[model samples]
Target chain A: MITIFGKPLLLLYGQLTLGLINGAFYALLSLGLAVIFGLLNIINFAHGALFMLGGFVAWALLEYLDIGYWPALVLAPLIVGVFGVVMEKTLINRLYKLDHLYGLLLTFGCALIIEGLARNEFGSSGVPYPIPDELRGPLDLGFMMLPAYRAWVVVAAAGVCLATWLVIEKTRIGSTLRAATENAPLVQAFGVNVPRLITLTYGAGVALAAFAGVLAAPIYSVNPNMGANFIITVFAVVVIGGMGSILGSIVTGFGLGILEGLTKVYYPQASATVVFMVMVIVLLARPAGLFGKA
Target chain B: MPMSRRALLATAAATALPVRPARAEKPTLKIGVLTDLSGPYKDLAGPGAVDAARMAVEESGLAAKGINIEVLSANHQNKADVGASVAREWYDRDGVDIILEVANSGVALAVAGVTKEKNKVYINSGAATSDLTGAQCNANTIHWVYDTYMLAHSTGAAMVKTGGDSWFLIVADYAFGHALQRDSTDFVQKAGGTVLGAVRYPFPSTTDFSSFLVQGQASGAKVLGLASAGTDVINLIKQAHEFGIKMRIAGLLIFLTDVHSLGLEVSQGLTLTESFYWDLNADTRRFADKFARRQPGRRPTMVHAGVYSSGLHYLKTVGDMGLAQARADGAATVARMKATPTSDDCFGPGSIRADGRKLCPAYLFEVKKPSESKGPWDYYKLLATTPADEAFRPLSASACPLVKA
Candidate 1:
């Protein structure tokens, strides 16, 4: 309840943390988008829908099979990743020889069909997913109380994002993967099995989205329209972060989330629009984006 | 005198095609339940509303009277243009006599305009905008259930009396949200309370409301007003509870369905205003019990109850007037409907006003605590009842031309 000019600093910290929590999601989601776009040279327009599907899968596992949250956290991503593999092999693999727009359109259409089917089955008032029993209460800081689950979301998301960055940047497998993106035929000539790598990369990218979805289920109720709500804002995050830079995506996601939170406290009404405004400003100023290579 | 055989044959064939008679037996009246069956309002009004109407028609025994009634339904998808188009097709091509259960205010208003132009009746049970009977009022539309004004007035006045003085609002940014804010602000001010601060979130888009809640919490207001409905209201309440906001939350428009979605643990002690509650009395419970048999595991919200009440009243009026006469003139049918008293097991005895607002008592309900052990769907405890005359805006205050005339 620390007040500066009648504005509570605790309230400000709470909002910033909330923003950071949202940014954690943004960071995770944009990282997946950037990763998929980097190797596949195609935007996974269905990434958001996959994220939503992850939540439903987790919910279904809990509701139907009596499986708990901890297992579903791991299982949901694996299931969605396999689904992404199948999608890449059967549908998306054919479009690689065509224009990039075909890939975009094909994935966009896939997203719509998936969302429609989910809506038809679930009907849109979201089913609530309760917080895990251990994480039910809030942490009592001297100044303010923060929900334990939300704090975990930020910390866990940052860990995952950093781990993903390290896997791509400092590993031997990452070099080969980057090489395949630059020259698939050359990489294949070097006996790297580039086509299989492409499929697996897409799967991994989609799995990242599903992972975020599982994390998000308890925060936002599981609903068909959940993905559509964040997809546009996430796209803005990707654009501002640069489409192919992993670190850039993570930084930009968290930064914009915090900025949006600050805006909510200071101006309130412009919070939703602020992220997109920053996107526009960034695009106009640096066409290649903050971390994008020309 | 020498008429050709070809001419005689042509005249005979023309008469064989069956000319429509100037005076015919009464045709079946078609009622369309156009509402959101797939979007956010689906659980609030969707198929339950349709089932409620069917139940009303079944109970009316109109079939025994040699009067046939048909119920047609479609999913409006919560879009205004789509609702307008559905209303047009129902009225013009399908011969649907009246439309009911319009849920979204934007869509409801659009359908209201369509009804006016097409000379058809629209009984709005799900939408909550007073403008339907106020500035945007039409001769062809009856705002059957609750409206934002009634809710704001009931909830605001009650909270103010209970010592929740200053307020902050997290409003959904839309027509319905704006109307609720405006109406509630007026009531709060009149009750000698002040609105400290407020924020508007994009309707249905901002799934996260933590920032908004923090702002409200920081406002140091005694009461926090949730001027949103459906999942938005449910989510905000759950988050606020987790954050441990000490302010008394006044939920302006919360349906029973929302409470059911959020269990008693999170929803307990929430004060809201509703026109009808299933567990209110014997009549309401009886109707609700019967509705449960049809829906199976789902309880009736006020909107669902509104559909039944309005549907039954409409059928009774049509039966008395004869379907043919009712269909011949839409305005006259509506006028006759206004003249009749609205009595059903759901709402009990009520009546419609000149501005097409259905007059009924509204109740202030507090959600039952978890320790108050009860069976499923046992949610509310009645706190106060605002009588029919005081529950809504006065006719003299309405900007409707019909009210003025």
Candidate 2:
């Protein structure tokens, strides 16, 4: 008979792989949210709906224009980003001077309208999105099988996160964006076009979310409720990682996912609540979070 | 006589003539169709159930009998409070006499409580928890269509009898999954099987199932039982295939909708038990044809079919005896339903069990091979039939308070 510890190690590796896939999604979504929050200081409650829109756009592109995954990966984010730019200009820009909670409420209303429209059009049943032929099969690890699409998601997500971090930290234009985040008026006085920068930043954030949605379409069901279900957990992830830290969000997202996977292997009942429990403990011990700056 | 006096005398004579009493308006029997119109179960029950209720009304000819069948719907959003409030509003203000097609068990159980309080009849066709008929049994609520017990009995018992005795469970971590796993395990053990071990999975989990599949493979169980439904089932099956856990797998509570969603590539050769299949019999075929006309290329799910059958019977009862009297005498109406052989487009000649679970032959279906070369919707080939007697839990085994009474 196999010992409990002996089986759990193999089980832990399996869960970690699964957790990493989920963490990839969390990292992508939170990275976008962090970018938007850094400049705008308004939590985009409609982020989930925007992610859902990305999937819908991909589905529509496939159904209407015979567009496939490669084009959709490029097209969905661009289209959704344009919409986000318009949203920032028309609706979100007006609430910048008010309490941050007002912006949250406004975004919440927008989310409702978007989700309601999707529900009306698609009904509740999810439509299947076929995986691209290249990403269809599994890679046989000696101990476990790895899905090609899932492995791609992890690699692509890490690439996106690192790219975003490097651009913000190293580039001159990124320094201007950071300066605008600190004081928009001061940056504007220096001819930085802070408002336009803010709008572009918001659009970029939304585009990232859409990109994640495109990545997730083949893995999960493309349904209206898909984003709403995941957004809450992402919010918890963001909170636990601290909203301000870009690298913190990415690291915590992936780490927590592996932790959740391990819990599923050893104690499955607590898998759902384990992340939340970790969040609570972090809040009590170190409110700034592990990677968060004080 | 004078001219004016003669005119008055004629008018008085006309007024004095006897007139026939105005025909009494037939009492309208209000039926409320409550379901999750905008929640997780919406696709399963939402418009499909409403369409089912409409079909039942048309079939029963209740409109011709001066029975006003008013169908009211609401989106409960899977909240017990919203469901109960809707039931109350329908009962108190809308004059709703019967509530049908509640999908969420939490909402269904709450609505059952409200129906009991209001003395209105509830025909539950959507909720799967067996407790509505068990500990929470109400005199006015009937557990229609399917429940956890039926699912466990048919799938688990049948597997055990076939000598696939040892069991491992991949259960969703919730009340529904827990009940399904527990009930099915009991049946497995009673049929001379051993439950090796079980694993709980969180609801809406999107990660890989390699870990859980590995656990099941290590358990050394001959049969791996999945106690979750919908996308969870799809993911589990897909992962199980990828991991190559070739144990005899059984889905304890899979629906035709689940099978359709999964398609043959993933679901092929899997054994599942279902009370109704669109291709089962001539009567079912006819019903599917009519249902397809309304929904356009979608066969009615068992729950949708259940709504139609339960609604038709309820209307028949209302037509035979008035709504007030039907509510006053619950058992008599159920007795009438049992005595009468029900023939519908969905299921033919089905009867109601004493425990209120509709009795019909359930089929163990194996997903057809890819080479079967049939058109769309030609998914399953029937394996074996569990006759009505063996299809559901026996009344003696049911712990429903009413059964003991």
Candidate 3:
């Protein structure tokens, strides 16, 4: 093994890779939050709950319907996306005209109800979802052995983030979305159907969270509180990256995740609180965030 | 949000309507099983514990003596604040005579103070921290079953003797985990083993232990010690298996349910210690058979057995003296319980110490291999049993003010 600064390079490599994997989840979750906030101007406090719903739905599909991972990967997000549409049409639509705090409160209530229901059904003990057979063993990367599934998570999450950034930053529909965010009335006068677009945008943002949940099911045990655990750190990530910029959220999520991994190696006690510390620092320095246009 | 006039009228009507028969003549003995009904320790101490308590009351023949025994239960959700509030409510408004089966140590510690303040009894079965008897000891609380000291003494010493020395600890960042790590580390050192390092992950929220496992592997320790319980144990073991880490893993605080969750494939060969096991002896099996009748597929965990042992002993104490007299003074009733020896089919025979800790022998159990399984719930094979006196902390070492010089 290569030695770096009197420590084995494989050990540092393993930690950094794990950090990147954790960052990938943060990036996907935060990107969705940014997209929703960009158009709706309301923070999706239930984003984490929706993510948990995604994993549960995937687990249910595998358990009840005998649908395997491949099908669940595609179907889970769609099912959650539809649930998001229904939530937006029914409860969230009514709160858009009120204070943003109302939207936050409503979503927070939705999260609690969802979590409580899941807890009642599943209990707090997490049920295991096996890693797919193909991704079961370790990949012998000459210097270090990386678990195949973890490698897939890092690559898959990065690919999803990149694709999402491309779709929003390029193409005509993406331009329409940006223009609507700037001036909804102007886009409406152009026969753009801004309301329908808003509903779909919210649905799409929620779909991203659900997708991340499906990806996480095999790695983390499927449980009710899983979303609640990650959501707070992700909120810190969104704040550090700013609420309105998708690219900023993606970059900040991964950066903080790696930083957290490094903290675990050098100073293990601060790993949990490190993300929030970075958030505080970022807020103090750049009131609007790293990439947010102030 | 003022109450509607209609709601005020209804409240007034309800308050004016109810008057029951005199409670002084036939007072009810209410036993509240405050536990984690939905959280991590649920399977270990939730509905199963309630069943154990009910069975104790049923088998005690207290009904023949006109002692109206009532059992109430609630989910603490593993939060200390929530547990304290529920315990407060149970004592103040509900008239719950005693509270038992607090599983999480943090929750148990929080509720212990409340029970002491309210002059009610608490019998802890699930919490692992010995401080419940040592520093946090009170007249109103009795720590039944097992504690971290017993587990560390039994398992850590066993592992070290088996040549699984040089240690790396992955501890849950909480009170119980800290106690387990501290107590077990002392045992490891006493056994002439060295501890390389330890990593503490946030409790409850940490799902992935891959990075932690990597750190453990790099520590170059022969044994990896897990100072956590419930799902955290299951996840850590599963991830370690996935990583193909060959180091002997010392499970500091685990239950049969955690093994069941991991399945024999992953949990096989794990050695842990417990105060009771269903298949340990004939007496344990007899109680286990009856318990299985209610909770069909699952076996009685040590904590569930503790509930029955403590519950049976508590009711016998209540039945000897009238419920009205016992209900008047919680500390006096606990003193009477301490005066009597603890005996039940589950935990054979033991005695409650002056510090409110029930002294019982702890058995070391090695998880059975998959091929060794004869049928369902056939999990463990007994390795060795640590005698009662040697298993727990000495009274001289206890910091409890209740322990007179």
Please state how well chain A of candidate 1 matches the true chain A, as a TM-score. Answer: 0.97
* DockQ winner: 3
Q: Say which docking band candidate 3 falls in.
A: medium
For B1-405, candidate 2 gives per-residue lDDT tens digits of 556987999999999999978988667777788898876566667888988988898889868866667777788888899999999999889878888999988899999999888877889988989888777876778776778887888888878888899999998888899999999989999999999999987776444466677778877899999998766776677667644577988988776666665566666788887777788778888888888889886887788888998999888877777666875655566666666766676666777766666777777777777678386678878878878777777778788777887
lDDT of 3 by residue, B245-330 (tens): 88998898889888876768878999899888898889999999999999887799999999998999999998887777889999
lDDT by residue for model 1 (B13-49), tens: 9989987889766558798999888778888799899
Candidate order by TM-score, decreasing, is 1, 3, 2
| Lowest-sum lDDT 10-residue window in model 2 chain A | A1-10
Q: Once superposed on the true structure, which residue ranges of model 3 sit more than 4 Å away at CA?
A: A1-6, B1-25, B281-299, B374-376
Stretches off by above 4 angstroms in model 1 are A1-10, A141-143, B1-26, B373-375
List-wise, what DockQ does each model earn?
0.54, 0.32, 0.57
lDDT of 1: 0.89
Worst 10 residues of 2 chain B by lDDT: B202-211
**TM-score for candidate 3:** 0.93
Q: Which of the predicted structures, 1 or 2, would earn the higher DockQ when compared with the native?
A: 1
Lowest summed lDDT window (length 10), candidate 1 chain A: A1-10
Per-residue error for B340 in candidate 3, Å, reads 1.7
